[model samples]
Target: MQPAVTERDLNQADVADAARYLAGRIVPTPMLGCPELDELAGTRLLLKAENLQHSGSYKMRGATVAVGRLAAAGQATGVVCQSTGNHAAAVAQAARRHGLAAVVVLPPDAAPAKVARAAAAGACVLRADGDPHEVVRQVHADTGYPVIDAYDHPDVVAGQGTAALELIEAAEAAGTPLDALVVPVGGGGGAAGAVLAATGRGIDVYGVEPYGCDSLARSLAAGHRVPVTPAATLADGLRPACVGALPFRVLRDSGIDAVGVGDDAIAHAFRLIVTHLKLVVEPSGAAALAGALRVAETSTHRTVGVLLTGGNVEADLVGRLMEGSAA
Candidate 1:
């Protein structure tokens, strides 16, 4: 068998190549600026509007690349993956675009909108109460289909990095290069991708998590991979029990920092984004801005870039959050 791939095997070039391959296939989401948010944070904030991306999240970037590769090989009858929400929808949509079937395993508590979106995209959606990874493995074993891990796969990581690469390039084109990049962490694919995209660019990368759901922070602090039973938080997408092994290696080697944000802060950021930016960012996406505000408290990052990861929140939750009554 071939030697197992590690984080070291992936690099910035892979991200650049992914970006090139995805040039016309995906949306080149806008880099938005909000004076109100900048004033509140006491620093300029460059928001990557990935919430408007295809499949309604940045997850589309990685899913497209992964699915396209399988389609190109002309062997996969279908693709399989497990996710809280966004990745499932993205994979389903990508598979549809490539004319391949998709099987997505989601947690029992996955958001209804996300589940509906995945199903609408023609994916066979399955809900499992146990570990999603194990369920994905079983699905692949039963169907003899290739599995595209949400975060661990090299192609996924490289594809996800394209979002950050686009943000970095957009900032430079506007003559305001990013000093810091903040992304809300789930399984850590996007954060690891940010690390790769911003490498050698003098950019400080940070991974954000909901308070008490901070597996990445704990893992970083412990100098090893650590798992946590995620706490109750509105940012459901960030509730992964632990960072992916590949992402942990990339983050640990890059010395990237992690931040923890509470629900209240995330809600506040959500309201602010909706009010000023006129963008309906989900709590998971808003958490990046919350973490950026915290980072700005002590850091000298004048211009920070935040990835608005997704916008697939439930209607009831959105209403509750907008009414300022969400717990």
Candidate 2:
């Protein structure tokens, strides 16, 4: 028998309230009807263009709620987090708006454009020598600041659900009911929140990750959160080695499906999105669309909603990726 896994799940009772709070703040990114994508997927695909979202990713949704929750509680002394890029910028921007100090710990090799954005937003950017987990530990020790985990906290997970909420409402209002919802998975918060949102709506929720970073797939199979050694992948935003415990719990309890797409497929989808959908999305953001194409090719899900999560690629990187020369 397989060994039992260990982790905590967040059944956020206030997820609906989180959605309402975010609705009042953010620009509702569009659910674009792209027939070109539909043909590529061989299904009706409604692309939620979250690349246009604040902070250039869906991270803003959770960032707003997390920082706002602290501010509302009168405890907004400061917040710290670790990220590859987009989440750091989101937290920094949200912290600035709430009049709180923000510290973003990232690897020295973090994306230049995203790092610049976070710095511009007034976050004290730290390039830690150790792993992000260690950096977070030391940050807490020195600053005693509250840590806002990118996708592990319930507030953040609930905030991520707003995209799904918006997608559902927009699809319904347009007289098109969705059958499945697909998005990229990293820490799994967005996908977990999506499961929470799509559960009773009779919509199947799916999370797509880069093949080399298929943490959620392995975790679900193991019946617990399992760590992995990640390989180089273009989907940097979705390259976490382990699924967050909270997100793992939500996905396991809710029975949402997870899939993986190869780097080649992701590259193909990235270019297709630019040329056909005319949307500028980074590789991680394009993961869902790529996964949906795979699903449409083999599955019975006819109408799938794909969340394009971010577009904050550096200029040189984008050019190299588009030229198909990026390693």
Candidate 3:
């Protein structure tokens, strides 16, 4: 038998260290229950509301942790990062708090709301014509402070893990040991962390990806990181082409599977979440719940955890989408 692939397993100590690294900075996003979601899925569904996070997503956790770590090490000049949306806002917000300058490289097609928010948070925003990921790399190479990656860095991965750490703890306290933890996979930090945390707690983990851009799913099937080709999806935050190197290592070693959901399902989830839950979650953020709704046939449990990652969609876009299909 092949030696069990146990390389990316993270221990309690590692989780504890990550928690401490983000203790007083990032918001402790709440794990919430939805009877409607439960009724829809025929299983109890708990939503971890990272949309309420300070920067409107769990990206802030990783951005804050990585920047804070650099600051503690006396390398805090300023920070540079790239994003289609949430990660730029995250880096801007965290950089502001850390007393560091922030320069964000954003795609020309990034959400207007997020672009303005990043500007409001005091980041020098640059519009890039090429790929957002490549722009991130170029900016990092040119700037010296530290690059706050969207999902690939070890520090970012560690920090993103805290969301699951907090979620599981809260779930246990409420007497609901999660049967599965589902998370959106853009560059894969959140899903990677969810797998590490959920498996550690003996809960199954699932990584949800957009059919418009299913990097994690493609990567997993190919047994290597794969870059996603351009496609049109409203999940702006899920537009990254490839899973992050560090996060991919964790996902592969942990044996977590990826689930692909169509844009229609994600749109439906957006409508359902906002109409029923009164929470305006971004399409990428809602991808995990979309997966749960579609992946129940593969599961063996009655309860699941879904990371509601952000609520940063543009109002006009939401209006257009809602008018089209109520999704």
Candidate 4:
């Protein structure tokens, strides 16, 4: 396995390199837009539809890179990871593709669809009610499997950045350069990647979190990492109790703004995305749009980019959300 990469070892150039490495390997999900949605936001909104990405989320990019490295090293027989949902599924799928045994530790209350996806990809799915990180460490120690951190690993961050890199490039190609970029923050991996991808490009990056689950926002305010017992919210994927150490290192003093969105706003964004964009975005992904609309309200950003991070929500939840919208 590779040595652990420090934040000092990562930079915008790494994101560029990751994009190159991922070219033709991961899905280049389309940059989509809807006039009605844009009009509602009062700006030109470019949505990076990572919900359409492989493994049903942008997490596939990072999982593939991290697992591919382990496979290439040939020193490890398997891989282990812990996540609320998407990362586990992505790592499972990536390991399967690379012919590596995979074990995923998830919370007992993890989304059913997400759990099914990981199992479907041939991973040994385990449930732990306690801290998943501790379980991951134990799994690594016991099985000798390299642990692919969902948000902290440098390669993972670099891989996640490719999604934002593609979005920025697509926006430029379309002659509507983005003034800002918005991404949902769980452990802040994707947001940190966004900061890297938009560096030197003058695009302001915003990390969105569910209101009571806003560890990133709270950490920024505290000027250090602050842990929160995440509250119940529609965006289950955004419920990490703390922003990841590596991601915090990348985001601290990076001038990236943090936005706290509520479940009501997330639900509204979900409705808009489904109704106008015709996309099956999970509430966690919808938080990006909710945060983008908030940014549009307070800033002069004419062109904004939002990364719709994933689409692996439960079917019943979708029906309930849609039904709620109709009522």
- The C-alpha lDDT values of all candidates are 0.91, 0.84, 0.80, 0.91
Candidate 3 — which residues are off by over 4 angstroms? 1-12
The candidate with the higher lDDT, 1 or 3, is: 1
lDDT of 1 by residue, 1-327 (tens): 112234357878888888888999999999999998999999999999999999899999999988888888798999999999899999999999989999999998999999999999999999988988898899899988899899898888888999999999999999999999999999999999999999999999999999999989989889999999999999989999989988888888897889989999999999999999999988999999999999999899989999999999888888999999785
Residue 71's lDDT in candidate 4: 84
Q: Which parts of model 1 are misplaced by more than 4 Å?
A: 1-8
Ranking by lDDT: 1, 4, 2, 3
Would you give me the overall lDDT of model 4? 0.91
Over the stretch 40-61, how does candidate 4's per-residue lDDT look in tens digits? 9899999999999999999999
lDDT for 182 in candidate 1 is: 97
Candidate 2 Cα deviation (angstroms), residue 296: 0.6
Candidate 3 has what TM-score? 0.92
Model 1 poorest ten-residue lDDT run: 1-10
Clashes of 1: 0
lDDT per residue as tens, model 2, 1-327: 111112434443355667778876887899998777777677899889999998899999989988887887785588999988998999999999989999999877788878998999999999976689788878888888888898777788888888887898789899898989998999998998888778678888889988879889898888989888877888888888799977887888677878889888888888888888788888899788889888888788767888999988877767776898667
- Give TM-scores for every candidate, taking all chains together and pairing residue i with residue i: 0.97, 0.94, 0.92, 0.97
Instruction: Enumerate clash totals for all models, in the order shown.
Output: 0, 0, 1, 0
Task: Give lDDT tens digits, candidate 3, residues 14-35.
Answer: 5457777677677777788888
